[model samples]
Target: MLLATLAGCSLWNSGSSKPLPADLGANVAVLGVRQAWTARIGNVGTLPLDVHVAGNVVTLASADGVVAAVDARTGGDLWRATLAEPLSAGVGSDGKSAAVVLRSNALVLLESGKERWRQPLAAQVFTPPLVAGGRVFVLSADRSVAAYDGATGRKLWNQQRPGEALVLRQAGVLLAVGDTLVVGFSGRMVGLNPDNGSVRWEAPLGSSRGTNDVERLVELVGRTSRVADSICARAFQAAVGCVNVARGSTTWTQPASGAEGVHGDGDAIFGSESNGAVVAWRRSDGSRLWTTDRLKHRKLTAPLLLGRSVVVGDDTGLVHLLSRADGSPLNRVTTDGSGIAAAPVVAADTLVVVTRNGGIYGFRPD
Candidate 1:
């Protein structure tokens, strides 16, 4: 899953700080990693982009308006298409269909290299659109959630809500989990019916803690992960916590300063803080397990728990591998010089990462 804005100290800055130079941790090698292959998709422009993974197909869209699907293992293109306008959001697809939002607020859908349908939006879209159950869902910047008929590009229903005075340029995501459509708004998560825009349940993950609006921002981490009965989410300068998706109640809440959100294994939840500390906590009790600030202030992407290893990307184009048990750096690898902007994605045992400049790499640890 890709996230919009990790958010800076404030919403307007958009975490645009210069990433500190790469620091290769201690020289001991604990894991053997091999680069499987590399490919050039296209430049992703200045915005944070995401690569969509469905089954074994990895789909990508570029700021240059090019979209392609490649074999996740071979790094070979299966199909490719180009748009006349640059894309504003990452590519979203469920294998059978692909969708992208153009800079012009037009949501374009494609299938088998041919244009399927295009729907215009009233506001710009920053997050990856959601495609499920033959319906396309989008959360626009204007704080409106709408569903569109996937087959005919017809507008189904739209739910409008008031948003904050200022929101992050890096948008949040739209998730479809089972029968419920999960959406992260300014400070809460809402579960809505995928068929209609009706709200099924709403849960507050975090609340405004600051005295003023800017400082009071409590936005959902947006990039949420599910582990068994738990639906875990994090919020900026708010809390990292989970709720029982079935009951729509809070499971646990821990004060946190991370904006990128949390990832969970069966027993533990992992996150990379805004300050660059990779921390872990027990899944059941929300107890702090361990934390390592070795990569502090590096502008890290969210952490990916790969078995016993924790994988995270930095703004310096370096991927860091750390011990899941104690948060120790085990190994690191360098990619295209443009640095990594999106989280490293995994399909099976292979890890794929995209560079800001357009290089994609597949890595396997043995």
Candidate 2:
């Protein structure tokens, strides 16, 4: 399906008989946008490299294996590092430390522009390395989860599960909630002890219904953003549900058809559907509030809550702003022709986004 291809494998180049749709031009404008600065990371081809914001620094990585940290306010380069091999997934960080998964199935940890340690991984990683609790957690393409010592890069514990042959290549999320590390893997949300990788609780968020393997594949989409007391997540065409972080019980379940995942703004849950539709639901009861089809057929990234609007990028380097209250189109903007591949990050007063063509842009909404 189209959702499977949105997992960063260039849906535009898919061998399918259907052709990709073109992005719509700027139409309605309500909110004003002021671009602060634009920077280049590297050429965007296939590998997953994202922009991560921690405190005042935004870290970015490129396919050619160049990593840099830029000042969120002025887009000034704070530090830069180059890897020997191409990067697969994006970068992850705890503000103080950062991690990246290499094309050689290796994990590299960086801090203060220096390589702290490097460790070989058994399987190829499609998800970003998570740094938390003095450990680095990684979810590999083989459906394996491993934790390593943050300083020494020593393998501490690992867990593996059966994976489908054709799995979604999009990066799933690893969240740290209290003492447990919540991991989104193959249609399931798992809570594991950060110290030992033991399963404390698990919730089935997706089900296999397709006769073919690709249709049957169910994986988490974007990073799990916290909404009130619950943690909400979306599965690739499987389901989107929220669970209490403390009890690990489902709060609600809805059919998930998005490749880019979901976002929440304290009051409402927003998601970009596979059909290019944007929908908002009540965070309290998962009640549908509004849906907009203006961006239909456009490959949209995950929704980003900015001010009172929901911002999302499309396949043609277009950024859309929708009302968080009713999902109405408020404004739209275009990037440097390279479509945005990663979710927009909020850093203080500006919004940051990265395009597949290696363009990073900062916009200040006015």
Candidate 3:
């Protein structure tokens, strides 16, 4: 899908992008080789904290206050929008539309390149607005979740309440399960009504104590032949669970090493445990079928499952391809030596991810 934005050149500035250079000996992402196209974007003195890609359009925001829409295939420039206020992470669509956090304490929509609408925020608007049902759903830093009319940008209904004790700086996804709007925060989960900002439910997530266990697990697993080849040594043996969005009930809980990346498709809920444990549970009973212990990085960028494998990026800049069936190794690739900050997205069967180094890579298994 081709997206057209405001074509004026006055509203944007360009910045330089630090090059990945090249790593000749790396098994993957051999620097300097197989370069599709590289372009330098300048305008903000800060890095874009958020990235999103869909159909032929990929959108992201920079701290320097510029929003960029680039061609997914060729890295061609599509449109750019610079707001006076600081920008937030890219969210709202499955990757089609983008939303930013504004300095005025509001969340605004940036589509193609046009200003869709600007809605008032209660306190610090942190979570990326959820764009669906002709409205945008945003969870403010203060705990109130509001939904605004998508087309006319009118306030529908907002319910206010105290927010969590703290919101995690690490990024998490939002879900609109029926009328329950859920935001996964650090150590807790809050659910709000999408049409009206009312508390539907809240679930408490546990605290992660040790951050260095990842390296230890990797070393321990490496010493054990079967465990080393199957599970990364830095395996997480922490609590992992999901809460209900309607009544704030702690529906089910299990020990996980890290926050599992969660996905709620209509029929099933999908995500991975901190130690690379993958499970697909029936939405009705949360029962599981097959499992795998292949993912090893400690970061929380959720896994994106494709055909026979689940694709994940880690803190070491290595992209591991593990089989989705029982969690066996398929292949791994390296596009950059820098670690990945965001989760990988599925473009058909091809996987795409933007690294912390400010470069985007699209890959397919041979």
Candidate 4:
């Protein structure tokens, strides 16, 4: 039985007052960027919404279950669909079929903006479904993994792991590396055979150390950085590690106190610390290469490596682009002023960011 739910597990620590966010005194335009196009959806508020990008098409959903596929190049809607209920998790698509979990624990699949089928789930899901190979995979809060036929809503298989006394209410890892379905169970990154629910390999990144249930929570978060066969992920506020999927072995693990995910190029991995400091680590050995406290106490989302810049959104709706090599500020952009709701993503050379008030703005090099 699940004993407790830890919401926004990475954002808070007890008994300590947060420092004021660093003052962003003036706008310095070093790198030129212009808002290319803008779109709107329902207020996302604090949802764990992942913006799914397949080529130039970007699929995303609102808290009220309004899913839309926007052309990343032109900011035009390819299609839009609305479900009757609010969404718990969603907008996973393969450019063909999209899957989202309703608040009622129903997995609803859509094709070309039309509802294909809906199936009920036994547990709550916060991670966006992984839709690949004509299958929809969901990782629920109860530590269960299930797959369904993408076309017919028929249950393909279900695998349940022993539940922890406490679990996070935020999104956890659920991604695909080649033919294997990789998921996070507690602090271990487990690889499973996608065809049938079978364990391929399990690599531990963090372990329960503290006495209390809250302190022992070490589940992996989403938005992991993958470079070829090597995938790197953050184990909550415990550690950052990379696993060689091909060999089913751990590459490296370094202590990381971050609540968000990580992103990187092949050489270095970048993440934002819980205190809002940005850090860069060597991908090969997990060595700390650089750290920037420019955004401290700002409440940052996960980092996104785009070209020569590490893009990160803050709680005030400002997206900062820093030099990937040395963590220097390159440029900063603004959004709806309601704060950024999700991490910034790139599609067709346009940087797309969603605001808490449901503003989707696309930016391009000016």
Candidate 5:
């Protein structure tokens, strides 16, 4: 049976004997695991899709351009919006507003899945739209990135970059290092001015093949703070150099392994590589904090930090939770199919997972 919580009031299952995080407040005194609700909004796609939630409403975008918003707690439908073209992964929110990128590089804002506004980009976008710094940043296929007023669908500025061929999406996600918008593309690291779309700095990261720039960034080294500046993106490369946010030079290269999903916190670096290690390093000196080769496999998912826990999902459809301090496994959970498509989101004691099959499941600590 799926264990939800300990006894009737604790965050752990007493019989299973799992340790409870000290921060669990008295609010979520989960008893046993119960199905809050599950709604099959769309048919499973070949590639795992994700479920994006805001407040109580969750939005699901299908491969066929079907979008639906569902109640997070009740699994009830709020609204649905259909699209003509397939959508890229760059759909996100800025708390008050949620933005989506259509296949044709048009950004549409959704509130409970109802269309609010639409803005056209230079070309098709590969990354998710990020609402940050009072603007929504969308990266286009023609090596362009621009921002628009979060409320209005007006273009702010767009800058072009040297890029790879367009057959595949670019790798890397946009990383906001302090004030710089950082991303990996066309075998390089690009840091742009999110305010005006100016090229602040550039770098060459290695081996990124795709339209998904966020994933290219994941393939590169990760900075804990630089990533949180905006939302996170997927993997690709660390091909080029970025103007160090503090150094103002393009010479400082992030010499690291596989340009997977790596972000930083300005102080600590976090992410994993295909080499099968979830690693962290010091931002100032590039000193290693910890590296766990627990799941040494051909491929691995991006690693993220949950509180002090280092969480990594592997291709085998299992997510391993480790202590960020030592890279030791703390807890582990397995999904029915492929490990996890999108990175997992946490809601209190529950670990929210959106699988490739469009199944959103919540796992409580045992």
Candidate 6:
């Protein structure tokens, strides 16, 4: 299976010998960021766990099926739950309810840190379940989407598309734009009617090209940047583009070799290339604004636009803060030395990052 092959290969490294991580020069502390509080969860290992932020709460899960909601402002535990089976994907929440997928292909729903109900799925899920508008949406590896009542476990609807020969084992795009449920199917950004799981519109961001399935893979990744009606996402290692969800048309697409997703503000979109170069592009025309290779060879997560800085975490347990205007270093912070497990998220004025060793650190401006 493609999943097994992907699991063993490094998306960023193609050669036999891995390159050394870039050297980080002396810390020139420009931005004033301080660790506010630290908490612990079960080790995340390699699971594609997403840190979900809603209001002041940060919802996350560990590979061992331990899910918890923490107050980003105070680092206080709001609620925590442990599922019977280890999780394959998770930490999706709507503040009131949470959902996750077990390794056994079961969808579990929780409310107030208690399991509400469970439903069985036909395929493996890597993307976190999306909980929105009293419904929980699950996107599986088999190119299928299913919806269920958030309050109950009753299945509402299921929509299956033609399965591709291979699909990425990481998180793919699935979000809500106004009243439509926007999802990623291969290289396309599709808008679906949330009420009935029907297709509303489709916009292609990447297309198959190479001879083999692996080279032709262009699944859209998550951690997308959404500014009002404009949603920008990365199509695996193929390209980055933005779509007008309201008009159901693609605005622009620029070829970019990146395996991770992207994040941006109103004027610019930022992404980390597979080579670890940080790039900023004009959101309107997809033109290059600036590129920095100082952090090249360091595996980076999808960037987060925080205030005047772009925040990115690397495999060395370092969170880098760079200038939004020029991609220059502004500040850097250290975690538990186990590397960041997911992209950084902001909540209640606190910047939260999770480590692979299960350390959750909350930072605030000093």
What is the lDDT of every predicted structure here? 0.79, 0.80, 0.52, 0.90, 0.54, 0.90
Segments in model 1 whose C-alpha atoms lie over 4 Å from true places:
1-23
Top model number, lDDT = 6
Model 6: per-residue Cα lDDT over 225-330, one tens digit each: 9999999999988899999999999999999998888999889999999888999999998999999998998889999999999999998899999999999999
Please, what are the lDDT tens digits per residue for candidate 4 over residues 1-366? 444767774437454675789887777777888999999978898778999999999999999989999999999999999886899897789989999999998999999999999999998888999999999999988899999998788999998998577887778999988889999999999999998989999999888888877887889998899999889999988899999999888999999898899999899999999988999999999999999998988889998999889999988899999989898888898898898988889999999999989999999999
Model 6 lDDT on a 0 to 1 scale: 0.90
Question: TM per model?
Answer: 0.93, 0.93, 0.65, 0.97, 0.69, 0.97
110-215 per-residue lDDT for model 3 (tens digits): 6777888877665664445677766777655544556777777788887665422434332344555665566544345666667666665556545445554222
Candidate 1: residue 173 lDDT (0-100): 51
Sort by lDDT, top down from the best:
6, 4, 2, 1, 5, 3
Where in model 2 is the C-alpha error above 4 Å?
1-26
Which pairs of residues have clashing backbones in candidate 2? none
Q: Which whole-number lDDT from 0 to 100 does residue 170 have in model 1?
A: 63
Please give the range of 10 consecutive residues that has the lowest summed lDDT in model 6: 1-10
State the weakest 10-residue window (summed lDDT) of model 5: 1-10
Global local distance difference test of model 1: 0.79
lDDT of 5 by residue, 177-278 (tens): 677787655555667777777776655435554465333222322322343222222223332123344544443334454434554454565767545657
> What's the TM for model 3?
0.65
